[model samples]
Target: MRKLRIGIVGTGYVTDCHYKAFKQNRNAVISGMCHTYNLSHPKYREKQESLKKKCKGFDIKAYNDFNELVSDPSIDAIIISSTNSLHFEHIVAAINNGKHVLADMPVVTDIKQLAAIEKLSEEKGISIFPAHNFVYNEAMKKVKALIEDGRIGQIIHASFLSSHSISNNHLLGWNPNSELSKGEAMFDSGHHLIYQCLYLLGKPVKISSFKSKTILKSMDCEDTMQLSMQFVNGAMAVLMQSWSKDHSKMINGIRILGTYGSIVLTDALYFNDKKIMKMNDYMESFVRLSKAFSDNILKKVPPLSDLNAVHEILEITSNLYKTAEIESLRII
Candidate 1:
C-alpha cells in the first residue's frame, strides 16, 4: 500500500492538529511543510522542534516558499492550514498540481472564489475536502442518526451557542495580524456554527445575522455574531458565537428541539443532559473521518463530506455575512 504523502502549507498552531491527525492515520505521511516565516526564527524554530518531537516517525521539512511545497512531486495530498486568506490560492495550486486537498473551515469569504474552485476541481479531477471536524464528532453523528431515525421526530427548532475567550493576547498569540482581517471572527468561528447548522438541517433558504465587535476595540473584525436561519424544511435555527467571554473552560454546545424529544450536546457532545446515551468525544470523530477519507482515496469511494456540501455551507455563510452587514447598517 502506497502511503499518501501530504504537504502542509502552514506551520502555525492549527497545523499541529492536522499533523497529529495525519500521523494517527497509518496510510498518510507528512512529507513536507511550508511557511512564509523563516523556520530559523526563535518562535518558528521552537515550533519546528516541538513538531519534530511530536511527529517522531514522520520526515518533515520546512519550506519558506509555498510553491516549493506545492510543487513537490512526492506529495500526493496537501493540507492548506495557512491563514484563511490564503486558502483559495493554496488549494487551487494543489489541485492544479494534481494533489488532493484538505483545507480548514470557511475556504473563502467570497462566493466567486468558491465557484472558481468548484469549476477547477471538476476539471482537475481532484478532491478538495474542507475540514469541518465537528461533523465527524461522535455525539453530533449520533444526534444526526437519531433525528433521521425519527427518535427526535420532526425537528421543530434548534439553537447553538459557542463562545471562546479572545483577549488581545489570545488573538496575537494564535492569529497574528497577517492571518486575520477586520471581520475574521465571524468568518472563522462563525463558520463552525453555520456548518454545523447546515449539517444538521440542510441549507437554509434564507439567513439573517447580526455581527458586532464587543471586545478588543482596536480589532476591525467582529468578536461576536448572532445568526438566524430558516431552513427549507421550515425548521428554524439560532446560532450565537462570541470571542468576548472571559470564562476559562470555553463553551460550544447545541440543542435540537423536535416534536418527539429534545437532544443536547455541549462541548462536542461529550456532555449530555439526557440519560439514554453518552456523547462521543470530538477527536474520535476526526479520526473516523480521517480513516474514511483514506479509504475513499484508496477505493475510489465518494467522501462522506463532499465538496458540494462544503460549497453550500460556504455560500450560506457568505449570505449570512451580507445579511449581517445590512442589519448593522439599518441599526446605525
Candidate 2:
C-alpha cells in the first residue's frame, strides 16, 4: 500500500499536532515541509531539522518556496497549517496542482475566497477539507450519537464557551498582528465553536453578535465575542469565545438543552447529570481526522463532511462579522 505523502506548508506550533497525527497513521508520511516565506530564518532551519530527525525513518524535504512543494512529483497531498491569511492561497495552489488539501480552521477569512476554492476544487475533482478537529472529538462524537439516538430529544438551545488565556498581551504569535491574524482569537478559535454549533443545530437563518477587545488592547481585533443564532428548526444557540487572562483549565465547555434533558461537556460528556464518554486528549482527534482525510483521498469516499459543510460555516461566520459591524479584516 502506498502511504499518503503529506507536505505541510507551515512549520509552526500546530504542525507538531499534525506531525504527531501523521506519525500515528501507518498509511501516511510527512514527506515535506514548505516555508511560505523567510525560509532562511534560523528558526525555520532549526524546525526543519528537528522534524526530519523526529521522522527518522522517512525522507523529509524542506522547501523555501511553496510552489516548489506543491509542484513536487513525490507529494500526494497538502496539510496547510499556514497563517490564516495564507490558507486560501495554499489551498488553491494544492488544488491547482491536482493534490488533495486539508487546511486548518477558518479556511479563508472571506466567503468569496471559499466560493472560488469550491468552484476550483469541483473543476479539479480534488478534496479540500477544512480541518475542524472538534467534530472528530471522542466526546463530541458521543454527544452526536446520543442526539441521533433521540436520547437528547430535539435540541432547543445550546451554548458553547471557548476560551484561551493570553496574559500581558501574550497570545498567539500572530494575535498582535492583525494582518496575519485577520481578526482576533475569535476569528481563529471561533471556528471550532461555530462549526460545532452548525454540526449540532444545522445552519442558522438569523444571526446577531457583539464583539469587543475586552483584553489585549494592543491587538488590532476583538479579544472577546458573543454570537446568537437562530436555526430554521427554531433552535437557538449562543457561542462565546475569548482570549484573556482566564484560568487555562476552565476555559472551554459546552451545554445543550433538549426536550428531554440537557448535557454538559468539559473533559467528558455528561447526559442528564451522568457521565457518558471521556474526552480523549486533543491529539487523538487529529489522528482520527487525518486518517479520515486520507481515506477520503485513497478510497474516494465521502469526506468528514461534504464540501458544502465548509462553505456554510464560512458564510455564517462571514455574516456574523458583518452583523457585528466589525472592521474589515486584513488579508495578506
Candidate 3:
C-alpha cells in the first residue's frame, strides 16, 4: 500500500492542528508546505518564516508558488488552511491539477463557488474535504449516537453557543471588510455551530439572524451574531457567537431539547442522569478527523467532509449573513 503524500497550504495556526493530526496517522506523510501568498506580502513572509521554524525537525519541501505545489506529481493531496476568501481559488487549482483537497471551514463564501467546485471536483475525479472538526468530536460523536438511537425522542429545539476572546484579526488575516474575509463572528466562528446542528438534526429550510459589533469596534465586521434556523424536520436551531472581551469563556456547548428528555454538551456530555467526560484535549478531534480523511482517501470511500456538506453549510451561513445585514440596517 502506498502512503498518501500530502502538502500543507497556508501554514497558519490551524496548519499546526492539521500537522499534528497528520503526524499521528501512519497512512499520511507531510510532503511539502506552501504559503498561498507571495513573499512580497508581510503576512506571507511572517508565515513562511514561522513555518520554517515550525518545520525544523521535519523534512519537507517549501513551495513558494501555489501552482508549483498543485502541479507536483509527488503530492497526492493538499490541506488548505488559507484565508476563507482564498479557498475557492485554491480548491479550483488543486482540482484542475488532479490533487485531492482538505480545506478549512467556510470553504467558499458564495453559493456559486460551491456549485462550481462541486462540478469541477466531479469532472476532476478527486475529493474535496471540508475541515468541519466538530462533527468528528468524540463527545459530539456520543451525542450523535444517542440522537440516532432515538434516546431523546423527537428533537424539538437545539441551542449552540460558541464564545471566545477576540484575537489579533490582522495577524490571522481575517478582515471582514475585505473581500478576503468570509464574514465576522458568524462565518468565522458560527460555522461550527451551524454544521453541528445540521449533522445532528437536518437541513434548515428558513433562517433569521441578527449581527452587531458590540465590542471590537476596530474591525469592519460584527463581533457578535445570533441566528435562528428552522429545519425541514420541524425542529429549531438557535446559534449564537461572540468574541467579546467581557466573556470569560461562558457555556460553549450544544443543548438539544426533545420530547422525552434533553442532552447538553459542554466540557462533558450529560443526559438521563449520566455524564460522559470529553477527551482530555480538543486536539483529539483533529486527530480522528485526519485519520478518517486519510482512510477514506486510501479506501476510495466518501469523506465525511465532502464538498456537498460544505455547500449546505455555506448556504445556511449566506442566508444568515443576508438576514443579519438587513436587520442591522433596520436597527440603525
Candidate 4:
C-alpha cells in the first residue's frame, strides 16, 4: 500500500515534534501544513516565515488556511496539534473533510464535545487518535509486557511521580484563568498517570485527590497534586506531580510493587532490583506513536491511543476533581 499522506495543523513545539516524528515514519509522509498561530502577535510574521521555510525544507505544502488544508484531496489524515481551545474546531473540520485525525491530549474539552466528536467520527468513517504519548514510550511497553507475563506478579501498589516547572508566560493562555482552567490540570500535566494507571491496573474503583498552589500561586490551579486510586482488582496507585521543586537533581519516575517483584520506571525500567531496559527520550515516545499511527492506518488496525481510552481517562479525571481539595498554598 502507498504511504499515508498526513497533513498537520499547527506549528507549536508539539507540532514540530510531530513533524519530525512523521518524517521518520516509513509508512507515512507529511503532505501539508496549516498553522493556528496568532496573526496579531508581534512575532507572528517571523514565526510564519520560519514555519514556511521549515516546511519548504521538508518538502511539505504550507496552507494559509486550515480549511484548505483539511479539504485537500491528497491528504489522508490531519493532526490536530493546534492550541487546546482550537482542538475541537480543527477536529470537526478534519472529519468533515473526510480526513482522519490524530489529536493532542485532552482531545475535547468536555464530555459533550467528546460525544459529538465520537458520533461525527462514526458517521464519517474517520478515526480520531488521541496523542497520549507518555504511555507509548518504550519503557512503558516493557512495563506492560512484564505485568502480562507475571514478572511483576499481581500489582499491589504503585506510585507515579513527575515534576516540571512552567513559566508565567506559558500560563498567560487559559491555564491561570479560573474560568478557563477548571479541570485542565487533570488532563494537561497530570493526564499521563491517569492513563498509565488504567493501562497497568485496569479500572479504578475509588479515587481521592488533593492539590496545592505552592509555586504557581498566580495561577488558579495547583502546582502540586496528589491523587490516589483503588482499582477493581485490588491494586492501588498514588500519583504525585509537582512544579515547584524542579531542580536537575530531582529524579522523577514510577514505582510499582507487586506480589512477586517490583518495577521502577524512569529514564529506564528496573525489574526485580535490576535495570531491564532504558527508556527512550520523551520525544522518542512521539516518534513511536507517529509510526504506529501510520502503520495502524495502513494495516487497518486500531490506534494505540483512541477515543474510548480518552473517555475512560476523562471519566476518571472528572471523579478525581470532584472531591479534590487545596491542601495548602505555601509550604513551610
lDDT of 4 by residue, 72-161 (tens): 899999998766767888899998999988888778777778999999999998888888887788789889899999987888999888
- The digit string of per-residue lDDT tens for model 3 on 20-114 reads 88889899988788877766776777777766666674667877767778899999998987878888898899998889888787778888998
Error of 2 at 179 (Å): 2.9
lDDT of 1 by residue, 2-43 (tens): 899888877666677677677789998777876644445667
For model 2, what is the alpha-carbon lDDT of residue 237? 91
Candidate 2 lDDT tens digits, 43-144: 766666665564453456767568888999889899988878888988998998988998888788787898899899999998888788878887887788
Task: Give the local distance difference test score of model 4.
Answer: 0.80
| Clashes per candidate (backbone, < 3 Å) | 3, 0, 0, 0
TM-scores of the candidates are 0.85, 0.89, 0.92, 0.89
Candidate lDDT (C-alpha), each: 0.73, 0.80, 0.80, 0.80
- Candidate that beats the other on lDDT, 1 or 4, i.e. the better one: 4
lDDT at 41 for candidate 1?
Answer: 62
lDDT of 2: 0.80
Residue pairs with backbone overlap in model 4: none
Alpha carbon lDDT at 189, candidate 4: 72
In candidate 3 the C-alpha lDDT for residue 305 amounts to: 51
User: Which consecutive 10 residues in model 3 have the weakest lDDT in total?
Assistant: 169-178
Name the TM-score of candidate 4: 0.89
